[model samples]
Every structure is written in structure tokens, then in C-alpha cells.
Target: MDRIVRGLALSTITSSVVMAGGYKIPEQSLNSMALSAAYVAHTSGADTAYFNPANMAFMHGGKRYVEGGITLAHLPSNEFQSLPAYSGESEVEDIPIPFLHYVSEAMGDFRWGVSLVVPGGLTKRWTTPVQKAIAEEFTLKVIELNPSISYKVSDHFSVGGGVRLIYSEGVVKSNSADAYNQQLALADIARDMEGDTFELGYNLALAYKPTSDINLAVTYRSNIDLDEEGTATLYGGGDQLYHDDASVSVPLPAALNLAVSKTWNDTFTLEFNYERTFWSAYKALDFEYTGTGIVLTPFDDPIAKDWKDTNTFRVGATIEMANKITAMMGFAIDETPVPEETIGFELPDSDAKVFSMGFRYQQSEDLSWGAAFLYDSKESRSIKGMGTFHEGGAFLTTVGVAYEY
Candidate 1:
């Protein structure tokens, strides 16, 4: 499988406010955050399980490394005020996102690893009358469990693959009267839905090392169609459609990454990475409902997304500081997938540039700890067809500990 995930960028809300181009969060670990998600080629820690499992084959023999961490995120306020009395900012709180990973040393040229991570998600809410009609609230929570194994074909080549299981939960709210431009106004109608689903996918990776200082890696994460079904409650407007069936099918796009890294002497290492996300798979958002006559009419229409694929470029550096401590910094430029015609309040996204920094401390022969921070600077966008507003940046901080033997 070959794919690069799409963006989940909405105005930052909650503690885990991770904003990228669209909705994909590649920074799942401390090192990944520090490196602006460009650590694939030079991966050496437990995060290798999620970043580049193939690199596990080059780890020290007969050793096990486990690491765990949590990241804190903040998305500032945003405002979108257009005609027709539609305007409002967001009220988002801080959130903590936790992750874990483990990688085992090579055994007969075979190595294995596992990871529990959050690939991407979204959270947003609005209070404005006009904005509330089409998009009052939209939130998504996801967790992924991946287990992988790698084989060393030679001293210079290794290949790896993993199974991906994702659990997704979501809440969506909107006003039917507003959604139809006041065409169906029985009492300012609104629809609410809460549901959860599970999906399956896979990923593949290849790692190549030329000599001891240079490494190259390429990885692909497959796409998953999120199939969700839950209860629907239609309140107000003489249309009492409550506790009914509701469902929708959305996509988690695939991602492909290519990276190259090398160390100069013993002091510094640098890496560059390029990512391609297949957002074209997302063409529309169509809701399905099974309810009484005329009950399902308003919410069953298809909303076109017309999203396009995107490209991301990342570069990072590591400095071997004194006392078993190391410093890292990175930068990245990411693109958005949403077309201007489809941009709206429900999922306002844009291109972005990010910067990051972090450090790690080795406490002993068997224990180590790390911390990192990243900031996202979103670009301002204006769409004539879709009246939306996004005015904010995002902040992320992470701390982790590792044990090795």
C-alpha cells in the first residue's frame, strides 16, 4: 500500500489541537513532533514502529525499547463573519493526546514492533446563527493500533509491513432549515447524531542504509473507509424525527512518504522528507437515514467535497549534545485538500507552515526521557462560494519516557 494521509485542519479546539493541511496528524511521537514529522529516515527509537518499522532490523541485537508519551495542544480563537448575519468564533479547550510504541532488536534478521497512536481527528463548534444552521458542531476522535515486522534482505536493505486497526467516534450537528437556506422552516429545525465505528487498513515500509551514516526510507499507509451508523434526533419545527437511524461513509486517505537522512561526524544529522496524500478519494459527504416518510428527505442530500490531493515537504536536524542529551529541530510546509467551492464552517482548512524543537535525556543505561513542542501557522484563505472563517494557529507540547534493555 502507498498513501499519504489527508488534513484534519479545522480551527484549533480542545487540548489536542493538531492542525495540518486538511486533517492528518503525522506527529504522533515526541521525536516526530520535534522533527516536524520528518524522522522517518533517521528513526532509531521506539517510535520506529510507527514511523519506519523497517529500520528496526538495524537496531542493536537482543534489545527491547519501549516509550510512552502525551502531547498537549492548543488552538487559538477563529472568526468568520459573512453576510446574512452569519459570524462567530470558536471556544476550544486544551487537550492531551497520548501514544505508545515498542521495538525489539533483530533476531535472525527479523524484528518486530507495535504502536498505539492517533493518526488524525477534528473538533469544532460555532454559536453564530447563520453558521450554526449548516455547521453547529463537528467532532471526531480516533485511535489506531498497529503491529509490524521487518526482515533484513541484506546489510543494506530491509522491508516491513503492518496491520492497522482504527476506532473512530464522531458527533455532528446542523440545522435543517438553515442547511436548506430556509426552504424548510417548521421551527428552526436541527439534526443531531452521535456514533462510532471501526476500520481496518495496512502499511508498508522499506529502509536502506549505505554504510553506517546514511539511511533512506519510504513508507505507505493504506486508506480506510469509515463506516458509521448511529442514532439521529431531529428536534423542533413540528418535525419530531428522533431516535432514528443515521449513517455516513467517509474516507481516511492513504499516505506515501519518502525520506533521506545522514549524519556528519558524530555531532549532527539531517533529514528531508516528502509526503503525498491521496485526498482525491474524498469526493462528497452524503448522509443516509432510515426513518418515516419525509423524515429522511432533508438530511439525505449529497454535499460535494471535490477535494484534491496534496504534497508536504519536511526537513529536520539532530544535534548530539553533551551528557547523553540530544537536541532536535525541524520545519515543514503542508498543503490542504479542500477545494474553495466546498470550503465551509464544518471543516475550515488551509495550507500551513510548522516549526518544532525538542530534546532527550538519557538517565541511565536502561532509561531515557524526552520532551518536545511544535507550532502551526495557518495561512489565511478567502472563499467566495463558501462563507467560512479561520483565524488561528495551533500549539503542541509533548513529554515521554523510554526504557531499553
Candidate 2:
């Protein structure tokens, strides 16, 4: 009885803000906000291993370089929803993710790189004493690893490609009594799900330099899926486990980048970049619980997302100070990919605008330090489901550092 309700509350809260868009591919956004334009500028060092691998051919110095950083973002929501049968309102848990990249420039005309990214992972827990009856808590984790290679087509044009491997796991708990008595007990069973899967895919990146002050770049990441085959453990006074081959396919949308930059002088530069996310590929998040010898089909609904593609625009400026210190600032408007009909407690997505700032300082000829901060204002989101409606907003912050040799 207790486990069933706890699972619902947990699942609802954990997936709310971060997975709000359902298909989140913002791993690159996790970096220092000042470097928002750096992907095309190739401004930093090995971080390019994840943003744009072809940039490796453009690297001037060492044959090999490694870059890594951690990001912590907080979601403080102001509005929430609660059912009479349930105990309290729904709120998200804390979120923290880490990323690393490595690239080698030598090995003939070919450049190679590997990236471990937590791009679109999420964690949101909701456990209020009053709300513990309907749902207790939920947690979800996802990870991706990519290896790539880039070949220099010419001095002015370069192309790169790679493969992606993805892994995912989750836990859901709900109150048996609240769900059974209130007629919402389908997910009342407390269950733990764990699985791992790998997919093969590739990416293409192009950079054309018309002049030293002006350059054009574009990158495209292919789509992939995670066919997770695992078992679901239901533990109570005794551990009764359900073994099934459950599969969840999350599409990695394709994207297009168009950029233009100009250098005012050695001390100042400006950059503009536009990106389009083909989010329409992410129509629905379908989890097929492959029932075993026992025909254990719980519920069935049409699995179609009907998502629309979106575009993001960013403009930034960098000012070089004395002693190799560089100051930066930028603004960006991002559109939400989640459609109104599909928006649910699992993902509460909304359109938002971001304001960011950061800096880089050269400590020595061989080493440098970078710091960046970003503030994402809350975007009002409304959800209509199960004869109920919810409206709310969310806030977030990101901080990071970079190193190069």
C-alpha cells in the first residue's frame, strides 16, 4: 500500500523540471555560459571534444589534450498541484551532473576524441509528509559515452563523425492503499528498474573560414535508441520480482548550427549563433514492459508525441583585459519542444530565455582558468491531464571551469 503511492509521487516530481521537455540534449549548454559561442569559435581547449570534434584539426599545439567539468543546477518551483486523494503538492529534487572530454590532434591527418557526457540526465524527488500517501519518492539516472574522429578535408574546410552509447536506470514507489481505495492503484506496486543498452550512431561537423575574423560552422548529431532488457523487483514483506525485457527508446534529435562572428580589434570580438533542434523526432517516451510467461500488461494508450522542431538564438561578446584576462556576456532565447497534449507530471516543460556571464584568465603560458555563470528565469507552464490542471514556473543556475595545455 505504502510503496505504490510513494512511487507515483517520486516519479512525478523527479521527471518534472529537467525532463520537462521530454527530449533534453542540452549537455553542451552545461559548460561556462561565456563560452556559449566557443563551440564555433574554438575559443577554449579540449572541451571541443564534445561540442564539435572537427575543431580538433584546428588545434595548434599539443598532440593530446583533456578537458572536464561538473555542473550543479537548482530548480526552485513556485507553483504546484495536489489531488484530494493525494497528500501534498508536487515539487522537484536537486540536480547535479558531471562531464569530461579528451582529444588527440596527431595520428596523421586524422584527429580523434572521446566524450563522457551526462547531457540530458535528471533527478527530482518529492516527499512531503502529507503527500507520502499518494507518492513517496522517485529517482532516475541516464548516461552517454561517445568516441569520434575528424579528417581534415582542406585547410579551409573540416569534417568529423562519431558513435554514441547510452545507459539508463530508475526507481518508482507508490502507496497501495491510496491507489487501490482511490481507484489509481495501477502503479501502486513499489518497483525498482535497472538496465543498460548501447546504440551505434554518428555526427558531422563543418567549419569554413572565409577570413581570420569571420568563420562559419555547422554540426549534426544522429539519432539513437536504448533497448533496455532488465527485470523489475517488487519488494514488500517478501521480495517478489518480475523479470521482463523492458525497452525505452529516446531519440537524439538532429541539429543545425549557423554562426557569424567579427573581430572589432585584438581586444574585442563579437559572435552570433543560431541552432535548430529537430525535436519532432521525440514524439513520445514509450516503455514497453515485455511481459514474461505471465501476460502482465497493466495499461495501454496510444504512444504518439507529435512534437514540433524549435530554434535557439544566441549572441555574445568577449573583451580581452590586461594580463590575458577575458570577460564575456551573452543572451539566448530557447523554445520548448514539448507539446501541450503530451506535457505531464513526468515532464513539465516551458519556453525560456537565459541570461549568462563568465570569464577566462591565463595563469601561465601553458595553463589557464575559466569560470561561467548562467541564470534561467522561470517559464510558466500549464498541464491538463486526468481531468485536472496544473500551472507553475521554474528557475535554474549553472557554474563551471575549464583547463587547457
Candidate 3:
């Protein structure tokens, strides 16, 4: 019984929320989405504050920059095929995410900026009997507030750092009583859990321009542990088993980005970015319960995650065209951190390829607007026990406006 409860609890949280490369959403702005999150090196406009704050020092010195946008995300269902009794598909999901960024005018070689963004999250649901027993519904949401400062150290070098304030919420639900459970002779079991947390971290950035048309940048974000405390209700055989205080901790892993860009004739620019995510920080999932008279055996034990670090490569092209229009296109190759041994219904993640494109039309010297579209295509994955997962991906559309004053 304890082991069953433990396994159920672990799966509930593990399968909750994930998007790009282990639940990290790197595209937070119009330019970022248009370029498939490859805008780090040659960042411009207000978004520079979020992508590479060090670039803030290089913006036009006398004008304030502001940018705001929203993204509409559509996540298609994931299809699982295996034994006839275990085959199932997840529900499709649609969500709206908004973001804002601002950069103040330089105050003698020092500049300040701020950003509000949804850095990561996603929701997955399974209605089939077997799948629902482990992951009926799992959702995770995250918001981040970042304020940063940049210093122009020389004619060609700048440095920046920021404070990361993040808030996260999680929901997990599961149930048993289906044919599969009955076949195993397991008693009826169910669980419902909700929790939230606020955490802190930091980010650092460096930008260097060795020539008029070349830009190089590097950025690092520290990891944060979200310790969520809330209540959990467990049921067994149609009877309430335990209801009390419950807690769990998950890591918002650290990441490092290195990028470079080159411009030709001041009209065409190309950039490449390499990202490394330290998902190894996510070592385990352990839940705590404070319910009197409840036997906590395997329920209190730690479940190993053993996720590995991953690498992603991205390339983008931006063209300054006629009619004050700027066009951009990007492609990325993303790797999954979840190993086959640990993969499950909640997070059937796999390697992916991303493609994106967009255009911005300058309305005037001070205002510009545009839209971007991105598509993530996941490769089919074969899990030892779960069989094969296929037909899963995400589509995003973004509209944004930027202004200078």
C-alpha cells in the first residue's frame, strides 16, 4: 500500500508541467519567438532587458524602450500506443501567455531594465482508464519578475546581472478503479493535490562587440528550488484515507547561453546560439505529509529522477527590408533531458526541431508592431514499459508592439 501510494504521488508531480526541454520556456517575447529563442547576441529594443541585459548598455542612450506582447499556445495531444488495453491519448491544450519588458535611458554608463515573463509551464490530461490511474490531470504554471542593471565597461564590452523572482503553482490528480487496477487486485485509490511557491535566483550576462558588425554574448541563470506547501487528499476504497499538510520541492534548473551574431551592410544579420541546461539538479522527488495516525513508509521515501543535462542549438536570420519592415526566421535543434528509463505518461518528452518566422513593421520612428509563429515537432519515442509515444507537438503565435520615447 505504501509503495503504491508513493509511486502514485511521484507520478502525479513528475508528469505535471513541461514545455521546451524539461519545462523551461525560453521564448518570452516577439523577437525571441520569431527567432526561436536565438536572440541573445544581437538583441535590440526593450527585449534586450530579458534576453541579454548587457546589451542594454548599447541601446540609444537618450530614449526609454518598452515592449509588450502575448503568445497563444496550442499543444496537441500525445498518442500512446501499446497493448490494446493500455493505448490512450492525452487531451489538447490551449493557453495564453503575456510578457512585458522595459529599459530606462542610460545614466552615465549605467542602465537599468526590467521584465515580466512566463518562463516555463504546461498542462497535460489523460482520460483513459490506465493512463488516468497515474496522470489524470497535471498542470504547472510559473511567472518571473526580473530587474537588471548593466554597466558599459569599455568601448566594446559590457556586463549585466539581474535578480530572478519567480512564483510557481502546481496541480495533480489521479485515480484508480479501472480494469487494469482490478486486474492487479489493487484497491481503489485516488489523490488530489495543489500547491504553490515563491522562489528567488539570479542571472548574469556579458556582451562584447569586437567590430562594428559583430556581437558576442554569454548569459547564465542560477537554479532555484521551488518548495511548495499545501494540502493533499487521498482516498482508498471509496473512503477518505488522509487529508493534511503536504509539501514537495522541484528545481528550476540553471542554464547557460553562448551566442554570436554578424551583420552585413547593416541590413542583414545572422546569429547562432548554444544553450546548456543543467537538468541534473533535478535529482529526486520526495513528498512530505503531516497527517496523524497515517503510516508513512514508502510514501516518505525519495524517488530518483536522474535527469541529465541537455544541449540546444539555434540559428536565426534577420533582414531589414523596404517599407521599414524587418523580417526574421529561425531554426533550432532541441534535446530532451528525460532518459528512457524515467519517461512516463505525464512527461513523454523527446528530441524536437523548432521552426519560426515573423516580421515587424515600423509604424514610425517611435513605434513598431509585428507577429511571430513557432512550431515544435517532437520525434516519436519508444518507452520500455509504456510502449511508443507519437504525434505530439506545440504551436505558438505571438503579437507584440514596441515603442521608444
- Which candidate number would show the highest lDDT if scored against the true structure? 3
> Using TM-score as the measure, what is the rank order of every candidate, best first?
3, 1, 2
Runs off by more than 4 Å, candidate 1: 1-21, 176-187, 236-238, 385-388
Reference-based lDDT, residue 80, model 2: 43
Cα-based lDDT at residue 104, candidate 1: 82
Give residue 153's lDDT in candidate 3 (0 to 100).
100
lDDT of all predictions:
0.78, 0.57, 0.85
Question: What TM-score quantifies how close candidate 1 is to the native fold?
Answer: 0.90
Q: What is the TM-score of each predicted model, taking all chains together?
A: 0.90, 0.79, 0.95
Could you give candidate 3's per-residue lDDT for residues 1-405 as a string of tens digits? 233333444453334433334446799999999999999999999999999999999999999999999999999999998777667899999999999999999999999999999998878899987678777888888899999999999989999999999999888787766733645224456678888999999999999999999999999999888888888887666677778888888888899999999999999999999999988887777778876635234335566778899999999999999879999999999999998866767778899999999999999999999999999999999876457999888999999999999
Q: Who is ahead in TM-score, 1 or 2?
A: 1
| Candidate 2 residue lDDT tens string, 48-127 | 66677776777763556766666665555323444554433556545666777778756766888888877565444445
Per-candidate clashes come to 19, 22, 0
lDDT of 1 by residue, 59-105 (tens): 88689999999998786766775555444676674767899999987
Q: After superposition, how far is residue 312 of candidate 1 from its true place, in Å?
A: 0.4
Question: Which candidate number has the best TM-score?
Answer: 3
Backbone clashes in candidate 1 total: 19
Off by over 4 Å in 2: 1-32, 36-38, 61-63, 81-88, 128-140, 172-192, 233-243, 293-302, 384-405
RMSD of each: 6.1, 5.0, 2.6
